[model samples]
Target chain A: MAREKRRWVAYGLTVPSYLWLAVTVFLPLIVMLYFSFLSKMPFGTAEPVLTLKHYKSFLDRDFYHFLTWRSVKLGFHVTFFCLIIGFPAAYILARKVHGRWREAILLLIVLPFWSNTLIRIFAWTMVLRTNGLVDQMVHAIIPGAPSVGILYSYPAIVIGLVHSFIPYMILTCYISLQAIEDSMIEAGRVLGASSLSIFWRIILPLSLPGVVVGVVLIFVPVVGAFMEPRILGGRQSIMLGTVIEDQFTEVFNWPLGAALSFILLAIVMAIFAACYPLLRNRMKLT
Target chain B: MTRWIAYGRRIVGMMAGLAMLGATSVAVADEVRVLNWKGWGTDEAWAVAEFEKQTGTKVVHDYITSFPETFTKLRTNPGYYDIVVLNAAFVEKAAREGLIQAVDPAMVANSADLYPDMRDTPQLNFDGKVWGIAWVWGGTSVTYDTEVFKTPPTSLDVLWDPAHADRVCWRDNAEDSVRFAALALGQNPDQPEDLDAIREKLRALKPQVKAFWKSGDEWLKLVAAKECDLSIVWTNNTEAAAVQDNLPVSFIVAKQGAVAFRDGLAMPTNPPNAKGAYAFMNYLISKEFYAGWVKIGGAPVSANSKAVEELPDSSLTRQVLTQPDAIKRLNFKGPLSDEERQTYLDLWQETKAYFAE
Candidate 1:
């Protein structure tokens, strides 16, 4: 009877979360799919008349395909950059740093995030402005070498996204890295493995799980990033998120926005599906 | 044991006495709920105090930085605010959507004293029915550091000048860039058909900009720090930062007029206290109150020319603050058909890409 009561209590706890997911997540996506086929009202609301016209617009041979390809490229760039930087940083935090110092370093990683995300992006803009800190530093380092302000460029957007999200990647990878057993490395060395060989054979394989999580966590959002690209990236940095934002804010085309959102979701899911098989194989091999 | 029980009884009595004292304390007064944009509606606290001193109405003001967020709150829970400051575009949109109630302008005697220009703006009214009272009139203008540019570059072409590379800031939105570029290229910013040209113009300018600012504070800091040479900004924002923060900046009346906008006061359609909300809107438009609010907020009021004349040295007001001529030149953008808007957005994105390239 006590076991039955505990089971009932467990069910009760799970129900609210399930209900919340249904209301906030599943319901919205379902509604979005429904709306994606509807005509946009003059005042920017959705109408009852369903049509495939919006999807047909998306099939524009020139424009739609180009944006989709560009978006995937930008998303890949962000993910790759984050992984290259974040992995080393996470390793240092998880395997190298001592107790209190590690805690202190972790605090520093999260300190900037305490500010509003928008404000933090703007801070980078201030640093990267033409006469701003970065430009001044560049001028000081190489006199008359043509000052380079990084703001509003593709590099700036990539750098800003990396800076803002690298901490998340590091923290995520750190958890997985910390779970790694020290004896495993010693065992690899005992089997006549050098530092590089041990890292390649043992460490890299073990960390694949973390790498997968980090890539998905960072890549999914970076694909749809709006503010970072819009702020740091000049007109050239129009990513997928900016497109979605424009549809809703300026165009008032909910159906089109919904359709775009679904496309983004499908793209993300495809990436996840493609990655899942590889991750599972790697997990088993490791 | 008997002595201990007696002592415990006395302690319990004292604790009960303290609890009773806490419960009996005078009920704290409820605050009047208000919602509006940050800089503009903050004076409501002072107004509330003044109102309380005179007519004993307790006012509590809450500010929201986002238009959609505020509208969402109003739509979902109309009782959340006694008053809301709305953009004229959203005012009409909301009223048409039945998200807000029709306000009877007769109740607001001060609104009758408004400038003829404001009352007649088609965006501010629907079928001769007023939805909101004018609060502040401002718009996007070209602003720069006087020290850097020396003389203000008059034309929008300056934004696209390759020599100005990495020294420009824009609105950080494709649609805004498209609109500005279309206008710059002598294409109609409002017309959807002009999007392709706008995109072409933007592509040309993308290389010049260093950043696109999304917030007023970000724009202010960028200009103040001399990060970028120029930014397209709202007049009040540049004015407040320059005059108040002493930022080295000036708003320029570009050769081609800029985007002009009006923000106004409106009662939510189903406000919990409609009478109080109307009274608040009425009080906001009184010439004396309007002038005072504008002075502190550094926002241009839509009051009559005579009311503006009453302020001393207001000539040195924010560059666009008093520029009716600038307003005349502006091609105000209104709500567009969804398809047309989508096409414009596509053009905007295309333009942004061209600029970046």
Candidate 2:
């Protein structure tokens, strides 16, 4: 009787949170799915009919295919760059730095989160535009170098995205690295392991979970980002996210937009599913 | 455990009480909520304040950047807004969707003060019923750096000139870009006889464009920075670049004519405060408010003739408004049919793809 009462109490404790999630997340997702199969927005005066034409439109247009590929490629490039730059900085902070200075550095690394992201991206234009700060500085240094203004270029988009998301990578890696005891390194050294070997065999495999977490966190959102690319990439940018945005905002085609969104969600889920087994085995080994 | 449950119940009770209080206060207040674009000139705040004092009804403003946003907001949150200022192109669609209601001229006392052309404009009136009141209008003209061209270019051909390759910016909008291209080719932009030829022309002009700007501010920034020598921009933006930012730029109506756009004030269907909305709409057309709108907002002309006559001769309004030829050159084409709009969008997508490659 006591055990039965305890289970009831536990169920009561979780019911509110479960109900909140159902209302906010699951309900909208189900509605989007329903809308995706409709011929028109059911709310407006237009007659609504059940159809698969919205999904078929994606397959019919090569533009949508190209944009999806581009978005995926962009995600890979951003994730690769973030890992390349972030892992080293995180290592230094976790293993080399100590006490108050380490905390200060970590805080400084996280400072970008305090300000609005759109404002920061806009500020980059001032640095990268013609006759702006960077150009003037370059001219001052070389006395007449060709203008290096690269705002509205693909590189500028990547730079802005990296600046915005590198903190996530650094923070995730730092937590995992900090958990590694110094005694483990000493033990490896006593066993005649080289620094490279130690890293390859011990540290890296152990930190795979954190790296995977950071990759998922950064890659998923970057694939769906429209504003960063629009502001920085100009005419050069066209991603699945922006195309979806155009459908809803410019075309007023809600059914098609919802269909496209579900496709993107499916792609992201497939990627995660593909990576899951490898990540699980690695975690078990560690 | 019992104590924790008691605390939770108290919190829920307090939240319910707070929600009830909010509901009652909203019911008691006399407020007119307006959904409009941001930056309606310096005089708007002052005019709104004066209107509130005179009518004893609080005016609330919600700003959106695009027509689609206005439509989406109204569709999702019905009865939340009293009035909306949208483009004339959207007025028909909004009315057809039952998102907005017909305007009663009797309610708006200043309806007779509108200029003859604006008062009976087919864009605002559809199916023999007036759905919106014309508010502000402007034209898209060629804005070029004075330093680059000593004499202003007379024709739209300059945008496609080989000598100006990589020195021009075009607005990244489907309708405007397609229409401008059609006009440049001497075709009727309203109903282009040959869409394929227009598409080819746009594709050919891709090499000359430095960037496809999405916003007025972006266009101004590119011009001010000398990143592009010329661009097709709104007249008000050009005015702002020269007068406000002191950028070395000048605007001219090309020989191909300019695309004119007018935004209208319409009442949303089943507004929370319809009386207040009508009063505000009437005040917007009054001589005092129109005068302030022209001066503070840098509007080229007011729909009210009396407001235009009141402006000084040296003002931009006097120069643009007095020129009947400039007004004649304005192309005020109505909205495209759904099928036509889709075709234009497809062509625009293809153009963007070509440039991307």
Candidate 3:
């Protein structure tokens, strides 16, 4: 009787969470799948026409293939740049800095979060555009220099995305780094290990879980990123995400958008499946 | 265990009370809510306040970010909205979907004063009933920096000119991109005689394009930075930039004419406050309201001819529109069917891919 009561309690506690997930996540995904098979948008009393043409068109088009590659490449580039920049900052904050100063500096790191993301993107335009902030600063430093107009390019997209997503890498890595015992590093030093060797052999391996999590969080959204690419990349901004968005927003073809979204989801799942083993082991530490 | 049961019951009671509060507010009959682009027509605070003064009903608004979103909001949340602002192209689709109902002419006397061409379009008339009430309209055309070109290019051919090609900005929308390219190729925008010509023309022009802008904010940013020499822009945005922003730009309707679009007001199906909605819609399209809207600045040309006529000669809307010249040159955007739009969008995506290549 007691065991049954405990089981009922468990179900009562978990039921709300499961219900929330069904409503927010699974239900919408199922609806999208249904919409993907529709031949056209059914209106008024008209019967819905279902077909497999939306999927067929994806298979047939070289445009979708090229855009998919571009979006994935973009994800890789942003993830890589964030790691190279954020890992060091997080390491210093965790190891080198201490107490009040560390807290203040950590607060400084999160300062940009106060402003909205769209505003931050627009702000970057003012800095990167011709004869704008960057140009003004450079021209002040060196007289008669040509402007470094980097706005509306592939590099600008990378820069904007990295700035937007780097905080994830920093905060996640900081959590892992803070958990590492000082005694472990002391033992490594006592065993006559150099700083670089200690880092490669122990510190990086210890922080692997946080780094992987951060990579996933940043990479997934960056792959589906449309606004940053369109704002910063301009004419060169076309990607799988932009194409999918255009289908719904511009072309008014919900079926094509749904099909493209499912294809993207499948590709992301395949990538995660390949990495699952390594991720499982590393994630256990946290 | 007994204490926890009491706690659970109290939480449930609180939630039920909150739900009841939401229901009561929504059930208010005197409130007429409209959905439209922010600060456009019906949402104009002054106009809405004036309506509220005469009619006891409260006028409220919710803003839509895109055309598809307007449909989603109305269909998903029935009785939430009473009116929606639709572009000329969307009236038929809205009516066909039963998302909106036909507005009787008796409901709006001001609608009679709307330009005959706008009131009598096939897009508005179907099954002997008008789907949308004509509101305001303007053209999509080229705006050039006076600083860059001493002599303003008089024709659409200026877009393809090699000397000025490196600084041209095009809108990123597929339908508009296809339509403009068709116009540049001397083909009908609605049903282009040659689809292949549009594809080739877009590919050839891709090299010259400095950037593509999606929003007015981005277009203005590009202009301020001198990143573009010529850009495809809406007439209202051009007037604002030249007059308000003090940008040295010239708005010109090319010899081929501008791509004209009209904004209209439509009634959503089974509104919570249909009587209040009609009164609000009637007040929005009146000549007095339009005259006030023009004074407010950033107003599009009025659909009612008399409303436009009332504006002073110094009004920027009057000077830029030049009704005598503009009326003749206005090239209405085709009410292209869904299948045709899909085809145009497909070709446009292909052209963009080619641009990337």
Cα deviation at A142, candidate 3, in Å, is 1.3
User: Candidate 2's residue-wise lDDT over A1-286, tens digit each?
Assistant: 9999999999999999999999889976876787787776644444567789988988999888888888887888899999999999999999999999999999999999999998999888888777779889999999969988888778878888999999999999999988898998898999999999889878888778789889999999999888888777766766788778777777677788899999998998898899899888877866
> Candidate 1: misplaced stretches above 4 Å?
A1-25, A41-46, A61-67, A92-116, A130-148, A250-252, B1-36, B41-53, B58-102, B120-135, B152-154, B161-165, B173-195, B267-270, B310-328, B332-339
Query: Rank order by DockQ, top first?
Result: 3, 2, 1
Candidate 3: the clashing residue pairs are none
Q: What C-alpha lDDT do the candidate models reach, one value each?
A: 0.70, 0.80, 0.81
Model 3: DockQ vs. true structure = 0.29
Superior candidate under lDDT, 1 versus 3: 3
Better of 1 and 3 by TM-score: 3
Candidate 1 per-residue lDDT over residues B248-328, each given as its tens digit: 777766777677667777777667667767776776666666566556645564554445554446433434545667657
Question: Which structure among the candidates has the greatest lDDT?
Answer: 3
Report the alpha-carbon TM-score of model 2 versus the true structure.
0.90
Candidate that scores best on DockQ: 3
Give candidate 1's iRMS in Å, 1 decimal: 16.0
DockQ: which is higher, 1 or 2? Answer: 2
Model 3, span B1-357: residue lDDT tens: 334334333433444455445644545559888888875667777887888788878877777766766776666555667888988788888887888888886888888898898788788888999888888888888889898888877788888889876688888877778878887878888788998988898888876788888778778888887888899888788777876788988778787777888888888888878888888878888888887877666678877878877667765557756667866777777566667877888888888777766
Worst 10 residues of 1 chain B by lDDT: B1-10
**On a 0 to 100 scale, what is the lDDT of residue A26 in model 3?**
91
Candidate 2 local lDDT, B126-186, one digit each (tens): 8989999877677787888888899988889999899999788888778888889988988
